[model samples]
Target: MTEAVASDGNHGSGPLEYGERRLLHLQAARKLLTEGEPIRAVARHLVAAGGTLEPWAVAALREAAAEAVALSAEPEAREFLHTARQGTDSPAVAAELTDLDWWIRPAAAVGALTELARTDGLPSPATAVLVRRLAWHGRIEEASELLAARPDPGIDGAVTDAWLSRLYPGAFGARTGAPALDEVAATHPWLRADADPGAVLQGLALHRGALEPLQMSLLALDGAGTLDTEAGWFADLLAAARRSSSRVAEALLIAARARVELRRGELRTAEESAETALCLLTPASWGVLIGMPLATVLESLTEQGRHAEVPDRLRATLPQAISRTPYGLIYLRARGQHFLATGRSRAALGEFLAAGEIQRSWGADHPGLSPWMLDAARAHLALGEPAAARELAGRQLRGPGGDRPRIRAGALRILAGTVGPGRRPESLREAITLAERSGDRLELARCLAELGRAFTEAGQPEYAYAPLQRAWRIATDSGAGLLLAELAAGGLGGPPVDPAEARGLAQLSDAERRVAELAAQGYKNREIARRLFLTASTVEQHLTRIYRKLGVRRRSALAAIPGLVPAADVPRPGRPRPLCARPGMV
Candidate 1:
C-alpha cells in the first residue's frame, strides 16, 4: 500500500509511514523541488517511487509540481494540468491541482475544470474549487447556486463551506457589509480556523485576481475600527491594484487615499481625494460607497466653517444611514456635527443619541473613528448641560481608545470647558500637548486658543499672549476661519489685520512689525532682543522705527495692533517649537 499524508492539514488523520527507501525518494523529490529543479525532473523522481508510495502521496507531489509550474507561466500550468488529467481520474487529485492553478492562472484552471465537470460530473472537491472561482470573479449568484447544488456530508464539504464563509461572509449566513469582526468571529465558527478577514481578502485578491472583495474588505476594516492607520501595507496593496489599471481598483484606492490623508490631518488633500473618488464611482451603483467620502468632505468644510458649500445631495444622504453599519454611525455623527456648526443643538443632540445607541449596541464605539461620545458631549455642552457633557467625556476617557492622542485631546477640551478655573488650565495644557503630538494642526490650534481664552478669563492676559500667538499662526496656516474668529472674539487675534488703526500698522516693515508685536505683548526691550535674537540696540532701533510708523512713542501703545506679528522671534528653548512653513491653504 502507498503511504498517505494529510492533505486537509490538522483536521485529518496523521501521515502513513513509508518504507525507508520510499521515504528517501520522497525527501529527494521535495529537496529538488525546493532547490528550483525543473518540474519534469522533480516529477520523475516522485514517479520513480511507483507502487512503493501511496496514491495520495503521488497526488500531493503532482499537485506541488503543478503549482510550481503555474508560478512560471499560464502555458506551463495548462501543460501540467493536461498531463495530470491524462494520468488520474480521481476528483480529489484534480480538485487539488485546480486549486493551485486557481491562484496563479485562474482562467485556465477554471476552463479546464469546467470541461472536466462537463465530461464527468464533479465530486465535492472539484465542485468546491469551481464555486470559489465563480465567486472570485463576482458571480455571487452563480457561485451560490453551484454550492447549493452540491452538498457533501464529509470533510470536503465542511472545508468548502469554511472557505466560502471566509471569502464572502454574506454567503455563509453571517451578517456582511461592515459587520464587526468580533461579531463575525462569534457567529461564524468556521471562519475562526482561517486567517483574518482583511488577510483572507488580500490573499484572494492576490491569488485569484479579484480586487473588489479586497477593496470592500479594506472599507470594512476601516468601518469596523480595525484598520491600522500607521501601516504601509494597505498603501502598497492599493498601489499594486492601481497598477492593474482596473477602474474599480483605482476608485477604491482613491476612496482609501482620502481616508488616510484625513487621518494624517491633511484635510484639503483628503477632500480632494474624496471628490476624485466620488466622480469615479457611479451614483446609483455606489450610493453607499459615497457616504464615507461625503462625510470626509463635510468634516473638512465644517472645520473651516464653510458649511454653506456642502452639496445638497450629500446632506440628503445623511439620514438614510444603514442601521448597525459603521457608515451609519459615521453619517449620523457627521449630520450631528453639521447641525452643531449651524447652531441647531437640539437637532444635533437627537442625531448623536441615535448614533450613540447604535455604537453602544455593537460595542464598537471607538473614539479614534466614530467618537460619538465627544460628539454628544459637545452637543450637550452647547445646550448648557455641563454635567451631562462631563459625564459623556468622562466615559470616553475611561474607554479603551482614550489613550489615543486625538481622543485624549477631545476629551480634555471638553473637560477644560467644564471644570473650574484652577483645574482648567492644566487640562487645556495637557490637551494642547496631546494634540501637538498627534500632529493635528486644527486640534492643536483649537486647544491653544481655548487655553489662551481660559487664561484671559482668569485675569492673566500676559500668560494668554503666547498660546494665542501660536494659535493664530496655526489657524491662519490651516485656513481655520472660525477658529480665527473665535480667537478674535476672545481678545487674542484675528486674520492678521489690526481691528483698529489698520493703515499705519501696514506701514511697518516686517522686522519693525516683529518688534512692535513683541512690544505689544509686553516684552521689555532686553526680553524682545533675546526673543528676536538681536542686540538690544538693534531692537531699540526697530522699536523706534515701529513707533514712528505707528505714531506711538510708549511701549504699551503697540500692544493693540493685529496682523503685524513677524517671524523674527525664536521661541525659547524649553517651549514647543514654532509651526513649520506649510503650503498656503486651498
Candidate 2:
C-alpha cells in the first residue's frame, strides 16, 4: 500500500513537503529519461516504489510524464507511453494508452479508443478523454455517436457531454433532443471545489437563474484566453445581469468588456469601461478577486505609451495572483507584457514561460486562454532567435488549440514578425483580415502598420498609403497613440514628430506641463507633487493624461523631444538637480 502523505498545509507533513519531494523525484526522473534508461524499466521501478508513496506523488509523475510526451520529441513521447503501458493488461492501462496516443496522433487514437470501448466497456474518465479528443479534432458526429452508445455516462462522462454541447451547439439542444443539456444538469447540481464553465453555460441556456450566469461570467472572463470571440457570450451575460438586476454581475461585465476592448486596441473605451467597473467593484474587492479590470486599464495605458502612468493600484495587485490556475496565468501574462512594453524582454520571457508551464501542466495548452506560446515566440524573436521563434509559432499553428480564429490570427502575426520582408506582406494581410473579422482592433492596427511598412520597403509607397491611412484612423480613434507613434517611427504616414513638437508641447495643460517638466528634471512623483502643490494621486493622473497627449512612455521620453522641455533643464546624472527638492526631501 502507498504511504499517505499527511497534508496539513504545514512544513514537513503537508502539501509543501509533498510538492518538494515530488519536484526532487521529477528532476531525477527527467535525468533518467535524459540518459539511456529504458522507459519500461523506469516505469516498473516507479510503480513498485509508488506503493510506498502518496497518491499525489504517483499522480504527479503521471501528469509530468504525460506533459513531456506532448512537449518533448517523438522518442520521448514513445518512452512516456511505454512507461504508462508497462505491466498493465487492465482496462485502466488501456485507457491510459488511449490518452497518451492523443498527444501523438489524436485522429488515430479516436478510432482505436472507439474500438476498445466497443470491445470492452471503458471507464467514464477514459470515455471523456476520447470524446474531448474527438471534439478537438472536429469529429463531432463520431463523438456524438460514441456518447449515444453509453446510456448513463455518469458525472465524468457529463464533462465530455458539456464540452461537446458548447463546442457543437448545432448538434445539441432543440436540434439534438436536448441530450447535452440533460447531461449538463446531471453533473452540476451545486457548486464544488472545481468550476466547470460549460456546465454553468448550460444552466443559462436552461434559464436556471441569475446566480449561475453571474458565477459563470466570472469564470469565463478569468479563463478567457487570447480571442475576444466570446464577445457574443459577454453580450448575453450582460443582458442576463440587467434582467436579473445584479449589480455585481453588471460590474463584472463592464470589467470583462474592458478586457475585450483592450484586446481590440480601443484604449479609450477600455479605460472607460474599466473605470466604471472599478467604481462598482471596490479596489478591495478587486484585490480579493485579483481581477478588478485593472489589468486592461494598465495594458491600455502602456500600449498608449503611458507606461509610467500605469496605476500604482494596478501594480500592487500582482502579488494577489493565484499561481497554477488560469487567473494566475493571465496575471503573469499581463505582467510579462508590461516588461516587454518597457523593453525588458528577458524578464518578460521568464513570466511568459512560467505561465506556459502552468497551462501545460493543467493540460489546457490552448491558444485561447494563455497564448503564452505567441508571447514566448515574440520574446525569442526579440532575443534574435528567428529559427526558434518561427519553429515555435509553426508548432502552435499546427495544433488543434490554434484553431480558434483569434489564436490563428496571433500565430500568424508572430509568423509575420519572424519571416523575411518578401513573405511578410502576405502573412500580415491574412493576419489583419483575421484580426478585423475577430474584432481585435489593436491587432488589426498593428498588422496594418506592418503591412504598410512591408509595402514601403518593397518600393511601393503608393500601395502602402491605403493601409497606413486606415491604420492611422483606427489608432487615432481608438486612442492607440503608441501605435500611431510606432507608425511614424517606421516611416509610415503618421504626422512627423519634428513638425508637431510645438503642438505636442501645447497639448498638455499648464499644470500637466509643469509636472512633466519637473519629472523630466529628475524629481520623483512626491517631489513634483509637492512643488506643484498637488496631491501625488492627482499628479499621477495628470502625468497619465500628459503621457497620452504627448505619446511618451517615461519622463526620459518626454525629455528626449525637443521644445517640450528646455535642453538646459534636462536632468543629468551624478548630483541631485534639486529643482523641487525641499530641505527634508531626499
Compare the candidates by TM-score and give the number of the best one: 1
The residue pairs in collision within model 2 are 225-368, 225-369, 226-368, 264-441, 264-442
Candidate 1 residues lying further than 4 Å off, grouped into runs, are 1-213, 216-235, 315-321, 492-586
lDDT of 2 by residue, 161-244 (tens): 554443333343222333454445555543333545544543453221233344444556444443242557656756665443
lDDT, candidate 2, at 359: 64
Off by over 4 Å in 2: 1-184, 187-213, 217-246, 283-288, 318-321, 493-586
Q: What digit string (tens of lDDT, one per residue) describes model 1 on residues 1-586? A: 1222223222332353345444655666676666777656555445544422345445545564555442433344444444555556766556655665554334345565555444346776567566655654445566566655665423434544555554443335322233444444464332453546567444443322344355446665654335553557666666664444223455566776677666555666676777666565443323344566667767766656666665453545322324434555556677778788788998999988887776666545545557878888999999999999999999889986788888889999998889875568899989989887776678888898888778778887667777877888876665555566566666654533432456687788888877887788778999989998999999988887877777777877666555544422211112121232322100
Q: Clash number for every model?
A: 5, 5
Question: What is the Å distance of residue 163 in model 1 from its true position?
Answer: 12
TM-score, cand. 1? 0.56
